[model samples]
Target: MESVSRDLDMPDDSNPLRRLSLEQLRRRTSMKWRTYPHDVLPLWVAEMDVPLAEPVAEAITDAVALGDTGYPAGTAYAEALAEFAHKWWGWGGLAVGRTAIVPDVMLGIVEMLKLVSSPGDPVIVNCPVYPPFYQFVGNLDRPVVEAPLGPDLRIEFAALENAFRSAGRGSARGAALGAARGANRPVYLLCSPHNPTGTVHTAAELTRIAHLAREYGVRVVVDEIHAPIVAAGASFVPFLSVPGAENGLSLMSASKAWNLAGLKAALAIAGPEAADDLARIPEEVSHGPSHVGVIAHTAALRDGGDWLDALLRGLDDNRRLLASLLAEHLPSIGYAPAQGTFLAWLDCRDLGLGSDPAEAFLKRGRVALSSGRAFGTGGEGFVRLNLAASPEVITEAVRRMASAVV
Candidate 1:
């Protein structure tokens, strides 16, 4: 294990401050992976096994040392976050005002739903997506219209338009009546650089979507949690960056990239009309961010870019290793190229482990992964593998997977 100086400004892999043992690492991981048996290696959860940036660690320690673990007070974090977003992702210098903070990205989406939608109002969701997309919309009793994703696991805009038009009718008989009423009643819930399958929609793709949504005046809420993890060559276009997306709201987070999920801090950003709806989300949700989380998140946004770069590089390596392993040893499993994020989509249909390959892998191969069926109907015979662990761990996972299938 690498050591550090415990300095807020230092890198995670800098000169030695201490060393950690394999046993210690396993023990810590076991505490978090409580659902799995002791021998099972967990690659199911999205959290990274790597240590956080030095600044984030130092911030947490300092927060604890100073007894600053009280409830969140002012908007120090929001202001810092605004600068971070403007600098990091090149958002048109949008100021991260006090309204930026939310409990998490999921809550941000939920609040937006509450503010924009009435009961039974239709909301569009692409299939084989994050499971929470279903839960959040369902919990509100909102009627969800499924826009089945393309083979590439990207939103099919044409299909979305068709679904939106048909949703209000509810039945074949009602379809004619609803069409005559001509109400555009659905809002699209887009997962940018989508979870499970990591496909970053092109700028051209986004523009067309914006134009389509603008024509119907349907709201577009984009989950951009994986924006920061985009590799160097690929560009991550914010929905609001497109010409016709003046009303789009983008939900972003440091949690996905910085491993701050435990902190539960994320941002809800919007353009003019969208901002009006999103701004109505209560400050109480903003206050849900704990002091420790604020300290860690602020430190990560303000001073942890180098660490983030290293982490991205590591994920890239792991992605390549996993792909190579699948091709060489587990050829039956297919993986498409991932543009960003640490998750990989594995097509494990040929293994004959039934529809949910992840569960089978866990029980038989001692490798825990996310079941594909959990995403939606199209996700059958697939699984989502989180590649945020050490390279050795990923390689070992492949070995076990290969042996089990053979």
Candidate 2:
């Protein structure tokens, strides 16, 4: 563990994001750095290359200082999340009583899925979604159907309707009811502020999704880990906040915005009518979340807003810098600037890099990126780039990419 600088205290006006030089970042022992050789620049994981938010750091440090590391128990984390949601998204309907602590976003999503559907059921998802959506759902023995996004990177309701209808075609019976029409329901694993693409879904789109779920006997569970990272002109609509979303559940965390993924804390919130289903999760599962994670995430939600805002500003600059770099060095690679999270999805089909462009980038360019093919349908000839690095690193990466293609 390297010593974090005290300069982490929020400066009145300075780009905190770019402050870390390459040498300093390498000192980190995390998998993001240790996975690749010394020469390779690893940008495949969702981890940001910025310093931890001061409040989150202090919270963890304080807990350690007091020797408070133990099993987690309480309503503090849930209440903090409720307050943050109300203050930020104007989601006034959030009830702390309806929330449950989970180990992390993915695990929470898995648990929520179990509550709504049984094994051998059907799970619907948007294509080119987070790879874990496929992995986790399959782990539960559920069938997955894809609804690819439209050209504008927005939800395609027609595709969703087809998948929803298709997913609900089995005969009525215990677990089969989950995928059966006229009774029971299938699960729609939605990724809001969707991963890989970073497109912030609009309220109208969410409302329609909710209505579709209602009409087709489908249950909705939204992965909203990136909800708090929305940039200008884009507002995140909590799935539970939609009119017809009373049967949906949303999994969120302070991990993404505050860069606290290692903390291992997350929450699964249910809509008014669906709270009972989520409450059925066994108490034994609650023991999975770390006590330190609760302290760190609670502190982040309650006091890390200013730090998050500063991060959003820096990420905004980094997003534009990436666009400029791509335009200057690899004009043929199509990039749609992300509206929320610090991720850039590049269209590399034109580069003739075969099915997986990340392979060429890693081997020839010494830069690691997330391969698009693993993201399931509609992902061929694409790659996901992490835009959470310093401007110099981003520029150097593009330069290397250009060199590889030429």
lDDT of 1 by residue, 364-403 (tens): 7888889999898688999888887766667778877776
| Residue-by-residue lDDT tens digits, candidate 2, 1-406 | 0112333232324555776767777899988899999888888899887887788899889999999999999999989988998999999888888899889999998899888888877899898999999999999988898999988788998899988777764322332544444344589999998998998988898999988777677889999999998777778888889899987898999888877888899999989899899889989888999999999999999998898888788888888898888888898999978888889999999998999999999999999999999999889999999888766677777887887795
- Alpha carbon lDDT of each predicted model: 0.75, 0.85
Q: For every candidate structure, what is the RMSD over all alpha carbons to the true structure, in angstroms?
A: 5.2, 3.9
Worst 10 residues of 2 by lDDT: 1-10
**Which residue segments of model 2 deviate by more than 4 Å?**
1-13, 169-184
Clash pairs (backbone) in predicted model 2? none
Model 1, CA-based lDDT:
0.75
